[model samples]
Target: MKRSIKRLVAFVFLFLALNNTTAQSIPDSLAQKIDKLFSQWNNPNTPGCAIGVVRNDSLIYAKGYGMANLEYGIPITPETIFHMASVSKQFTAYSIVLLARQGKLRLDDDIHQYLPWFPDLKEKITIRHLLNHTSGIRDQWQLLAIAGTRLDDVITQDHIVKILSKQQALNFKPGEKYSYSNSGFTMLAEIVKAVTGQSLRRFTDSAIFKPLGMKQTHFHDDYTEIEKNRAYSYQRKNLFTFSNSVLSYSNAGATSLFTNINDLSKWVMNFYTPVAGTAADIDQLVQKGKLNNGVELNYALGISSDTYKGYKQYSHSGGDAGFRTYLTVLPELKMGFMVFSNLAEVNTYEKTYQLVDLFIKDTSAKVNADIRMDSSRAIIKDEGRAKNFTGDFISEDGAQFSFVLRNRKLYWERYGNSDLLYPGLKDSFTVARSPEIKFVFSTTPGKSVLVNQYWPDNKRLLVKYATDSIQTDNQLQMYAGLYYCPELDCKYTIVAKDHELILTSNKYNDSKLKLVGKDHLFTDYWWMRHLKTISGNNKKIIGFEVNDGRIMHLRFNKIQ
Candidate 1:
C-alpha cells in the first residue's frame, strides 16, 4: 500500500513539472523577466552583454545592458560592436562550404596539397577534418602559450602559419578522435588564401557579408584598424577595470571577428532562413562529426548540435581576451539567442540559458547557487585499499593526474590542487567535492591494470606510475640542458640544482619539476605540466615532448 501511494505521488509531480515547463508567458512579462535575469549587469558603471532574440525570419527583440566603453561612459546598445571570438567560426566554415560549391576546392583533398609549407605528419588531413576539428592538430593558442608567446604581444596570421608549418606531430591520428584545435581553422583559412589568392576576410566579405547585407560585420584581421562605435573590452581587477584590455590579434579564421548583436542577429537568422547560403549549402553546415571508429560527435562543421528541453538545438560559443560570445539556434521553434559581452567576467553561457528559460517559457525550478548537494549517497571506507590507489597516473589521451594517501584518506591531485576522494563500493571511489565523478580500480589480464575514471564530459582509463625517487644525482644531471622548440620559436633551460630539477625560460618564471616513472615528468607550470623525456638510440636523453592540455607531444629538443 505504501509503494502504491509513492508511485501515485511521483506521477502527479511529473505531470505538474511538464505542465510548468509548457506554460506560456505573455510577451510583455517575458521581456521584463529577461531584463530581470540580467539585472546584475544592468548598471551603467559595469561591462555588460548585448542580447538578440530572433524568431523565425524576424529579430523580435534586441537590447544591451551596462557600458560599452566605461571610460567614455558609452552606453551599450544593440549596435555595439563585440569581438565574437569562436562564434566567428561558423562564418569561416560557411566560407569553405561556399568555396566547395564553386569548385574552388574539394573538402576531401589533403591540406598539404594547397599549403606546401606545412610539414608532413604522415597522415592525410583533409579540408573536412579541419572544418570538423577531428584532424588531431594541436590548438594554436596552446602551442603559442607553451612557446612563451604573450597573447597580447601583437600576434598575426603570418605568425600562426609560421608556427604551424613546423609542427612535428599530431595529437592523434587524423579522424581517430575529435579534439577542438584552432590550428585546424587557421589552416582552413590558409587553404582559402592558397586557392583563391584572397584572404579569409576578403573572400568572406564578398561571399557572405555582402549577400546578407551585414555591413557592420567583418573579420578584424588588423587589430590596428579601428571601427566606429566599437566597445572597448575590459578585464576585472581589484585596482579598477579600465585600461586592462590589451589584445592585439591581426588574424582571421579562428578568431578576430568584430560584430554587433544587430549584425549577429542576421547571422543567427541565416542558419534557419535563406539569408547567407543556398538551401543545399545550409544543409552541410549542421552535419555532425564522426570518428573513424563510427562514434558520432556533437561537434558539427564549426557548430555543435544537441538537444535542450526536448527541442533540437545548434550552438557555438567563443571567448578571447576580455570578450565572450554565445550563439544558439533552436530550429524546431525557429528561435535563436545571442549574447555578446566585453568583460571577461561576463558569463555569456549562463545568460543565454536564463534568456532561454524566459523567452522559451521554461518551467524548471531554479537551482540554489550557494549550495552544492549531491543526491542521497554514502561512501564505504578502508585504509589499506585507499593507499593502494595512491600514485601518479596518466590517461591514454595524455591527461595526467595523481592520487595521494593523506591522513588515512585518498585524495585526487592535479596541477597543485587536491580533492578529497570518498570511498565507495569495492575498488570504487567518488570525489568528495564533485560526487558526479567516479573512479574504479581493477587489475586486467596480462599487462594492464586500469583506473577507470568517469567524469562529466569523458571516461578515461588511467594507469598508475611511480615517482622518480629511485633516480640518483647522476641520473638527474642527464636531464639538465638548454632546449629549443622550432615550432614555437621559444627556448627553455632545464636546470639541476642540488639533485632537484627546475625549468627556466626567458619569458616565464622557473617551475620546479617532479620526475615520474621512467621518462615522464610533472610540473606546476601550466604549459610544462606533463613532459616525457625523448631518448636517443644510444640511451642518452635527447629532448622532451610537452602535453599542455590542448596541445600534445610538442617536441622541445636539447640545444646544449
Candidate 2:
C-alpha cells in the first residue's frame, strides 16, 4: 500500500511539470489581436492586403487576408504581387545612389550635362535637388493635369518629357523651398538612362534584385508584360469592382514598380543587414534633405524619416488607382513591417502601425493638453467681439483662411470645412480637437492682423482686409476675356456670370473670383490667388499676373 502511494505522488509531480512547460511555450496573444484587426479583410470575396513582419533579418510572420483574384476565387497569399505606387520611389532613389557610387555621375552635376534638350531656366538645379525634391520643378503629374491630361489617361515617360521640355520657368528657385515634385524623380530616371546604356528596370534587376535573390521584383515598365500571381486592384462602389491602372507603365523613377510582400520583406531586411549596396551608399539613400537655408526636412532620398510612439521610423506610403501600400522600418528596434493592398480604400498606414503596436514595446508617456475652455470658463462678454475676427485673412505664403460667425459661435473655415473655436482668453481662441492651433485677433484699423500660433516657434500673421466693399459687377466686366499662358500652353477664360467673375480653364474646374482690392481678386483655390488685372496703354484689358507662393508674378497675355 505504501508503494502505491509513492507512485501516485510521482505521477502528480509529472503533471505539474508538464503544465508549467505548456504555459511557458504558449503562443503570444498579440498575434490573435492582429488577426482580429484584419477581420474585415479576412474573407474570400473581398480585396485585401498582404502583410509581412521582420525582426533581426528574419521574417517572423507573413500572411494574406483576402481575395487576390476574385473572379478565379484565388485567396491572397504572401507571394501575391501588388503594384506599389510611390513606394517605388525608394528603389529609384537607391538606383541613383548606386550609380553615384560607381563614379558614373555626380549628385551636384547640372542635369543639362546629360539632358541637353532640357531648357536652361538659369537656375542651378543639381542632381541632388531632383533626388530630394528641392529642384522647384512643378510636379510632372500636376503639370500634365494643368495641360488637360487626367490621371486615368495613359501617360508615358516621353509624354511627360515633352511637357517638361516646353516649360520655361519653375515654381521656385532650386533649393529655395521644399515642394514635393514627381518631375524631379522622373528626370532622375532619365539621368540614369542617359548615364547607363540600359533602362532602370534592367539595371536594377541585374544590380539589386538579382544580387538579393528577389526573383519576383522589377520596375515593370511594360503594362502588357504578363506577371503570374498578380493581384488585381479593386474599389468598392455598390460592390467590389476591378480598377485597372490605366497609367502607361513606361515610367520607372517616380512610380511603376510591381512587387510582392515576400520580395519587399527582403528589401526591408536589407536596411538592417547590408548586401546589395555598401554601408555608405545605404546611408546616403536614407539621409535627410537640407534646404538652401540650411533647414533640414523630414524627407530623405525616397523615404520619410519620422517618429511613431517614441521609436524612430523610416517609412514610405504609396497610392495609385486602387492600390494602397505602406512600408515602415524601426531601425533602432530592428523591426520592420510592410502592408501592400490592392484595395484603394485600405488605411495601410494605420493598419501597419496597429500591427507594430502588438510586436513592439510602448514606452511613450506623452499626454494630451489638460486645458479646456467650457462655458464656465468663458471670458468674452461682447457678441460683437466675434465680428472682429470675421473676415478673409491672407498669409505670406498665399494660404487663405476665413473666419465666420454662425449660430452665436465662431468657426474657423478652410477649404469649405468649419472647425468650431473655443474661447480661451480675450482676443484669443483655440481650435476644437486641435489644441496646437491657436488664433489671436488684433483689431487695430489698417494694421489689423490675425496671428496663427501653431508650433511653439512657428507663428504666421495674416493681414485683415480693410476695404469696406468689393467692386460692383459692372466694374468686373472689364476683366472678362480670354488669356493665354505660353509657359503652360493653357488658356483661361474669364466670364461675367451672375454678377460675378467666373474663371474657366479647360485643364481645371471653373472657380469664382472674389474682388479683394481695386483690381486684385482671390479665388477659392488657395494656391492660385492674389490675381491682379493689367491694362494696355489704350486703357483696354491687356492680361493679368498671378503672384503666388510658388509661381511669383506669372503673366498671361489677353488674346480676346
Candidate 3:
C-alpha cells in the first residue's frame, strides 16, 4: 500500500508539471498574430524566410514562409537550408575560440606568427584584431572592386589571399579604430589553417557543427557541392516580379554558411544554456573588444554587443547577394530570435525587432536617450531659409554627401538613402538616424563656411562642392586624361564624351564620371567614388586619387 501511494504521488507531480507547461504556452491569439506577421510571404510565388523563436531550450515557434524553390514549387520549411552570408562569422569565431581553449593558438599572439604571407603593415596585428575587425585591413570586396573584379564572379579563398598579399597599405593603425572589414575574418580562416593541418571547413565540421548536432550547418567551402533542399536567393525587380541574385562564393570564414532555422535555434539556445560549449567560453565570445587606447568597442569577436529597446542584446546581421539573415539573443530573458530570408528586400533586423516586441517589454533608456537627444536639438521654424543648406558637400576625408530641400524639409543624402536633418545648436544640425552626429556649420569671418561633422568618436570638416559652375563642354574636356595606378598595375583613360567624362579602365570595368567641383569628380563605382585630380608644379594634371572612405588616398599617375 505504501509503495502504491509513493507511485501515485510521483504521477500526480508529473501531471501538475505538464499542466504548468501548458498554462505557460503562448496564447493561440498571439501565435495567430505571429502567423499574420509573416502572412505576406505565405504565397506560392514569393521567396520568403524561416523564422524561429527560442525560449530557453525550446524552440516554441518555428515556421517557414513562401517558396524555397519557385521553379520546383517547393514551399519553405524549417528543414530547408539557406546560405548565411556574414552571419557565418559567428561560427568561425567559435571555432577559433575553441582552438584557443585547446591551447592550439592564442588570441593575443601576432597574426604574423601564423600567416607569414600577410605583410607587416608597421603595426603588429593580433588575432584579436582580426576577430574584432580592428586589424586596420582594407575590405576585400572594395579592394576587388577597385582592381576590376566583379563580386558575382567566382571569388575564391585563394583570390582573396592573393589580393591581400598585393596590398601595400593598411586602413589605419591596428586596434586604433573600429572598421568593419570582411578581409580580417578571411585572414582568421588562414590562421586556423596555419595552426591546424585541417581546412576551416573540416575543422569547423569536427569542432563545432558536429559537436552541437548542427547537421544542417557547415562552412560551405565547395561552391559546386550540391546539397538537398538548398534554397535560391532572389531580389525584387519591381513590385510585380523578382530576379535571381547569384552568389558564387567558394570563400569560407567571412561567409558561405549553410543552415536552417531548426539548426540555428540549437545554436542560439546554446548561447543561453551550455549545450555545446561551456558558459565561460560563451562569456569570452560575447566580450566586447577594446581599442589600443582602451576605448571599448561595440563589436565583440563576431557578434555585436548592443541594446534593443533598452535591453542588453547581442546580435548580428548578414547580407550577401539576396540572402538577409539576422540573429539576436537576449540572454537575461533566455530568449533568442532569428529571421533568415532568401530575398534581398526583406529587412530581417527590423522584422526581428517587431517580432521580439511581442515578447519583450520596451526598456525606457534607449528610447528616452534618443528622445532627449532629439528634444535638445533646436528646431528650424523657417522653411524658406532651409534652402541655403541644400547643396553638395564633400568631407576632407573625400567622403561626399548632399543636402536637399524636399517637401520643405532639409535632408542629408548619401548614395540613395536620405535622412532628415534637424537644426541643433547655433548653426548646427543632427541627422534623423544618428542624433549624436552633428553637422556644425562654422565660418571664420571672411573664409568660406564649412560644416564640421562631429561624430561621438571623430570629427570631419566638409566643404561645399558646387556642380553648377561646370556647365560648359570645354570645362569637362580639360579634366580628361590618362592615369596609371601602380598598386593594381592598371591604367584608366578619361575622355570627354557628350558633355560627360567617360572613364575606360584597362584592367577592369569603366563608368562615366560626374563632375562635383573644380578638379574633383565622382563615379557610379560604389567602392572607389571620388576622383580628385592632382596637379603638378606646372599646374598640369599629373594624376588623380581615389578615396573610397576606407582607402584614404590611392593615386593613379598620368602616364600619357
Query: What TM-score fits each model?
Result: 0.81, 0.78, 0.84
Residue ranges of candidate 2 with Cα displaced over 4 Å: 1-28, 71-73, 239-245, 364-390, 395-398, 403-476, 498-555
For residue 385, what is the lDDT in candidate 2?
Answer: 70
> In the order shown, what is each candidate's alpha-carbon RMSD?
11.5, 10.5, 9.6
Model 3: per-residue lDDT, tens digit, 401-498? 88887655677899999887788657678887677888877656765657888764356778876767845787676677788778766677898888
lDDT tens per residue, model 1, 243-310 = 55778899999998888877777777777786667878877888887878777788888999877767
lDDT, model 2: 0.77
Instruction: Name the better of 2 and 3 by TM-score.
Output: 3
Position 36, candidate 2: lDDT? 86
Per-residue C-alpha lDDT of model 2 across residues 289-327, encoded as one tens digit per residue: 888877777888988976777887889999877789999
> Which candidate would rank higher by TM-score, 1 or 3?
3
The whole-model lDDT of each prediction reads 0.81, 0.77, 0.81
The C-alpha stretches of model 1 lying farther than 4 A from their native spots are 1-26, 239-243, 361-392, 396-461, 467-479, 497-500, 514-525, 535-541
Model 3 TM-score is: 0.84
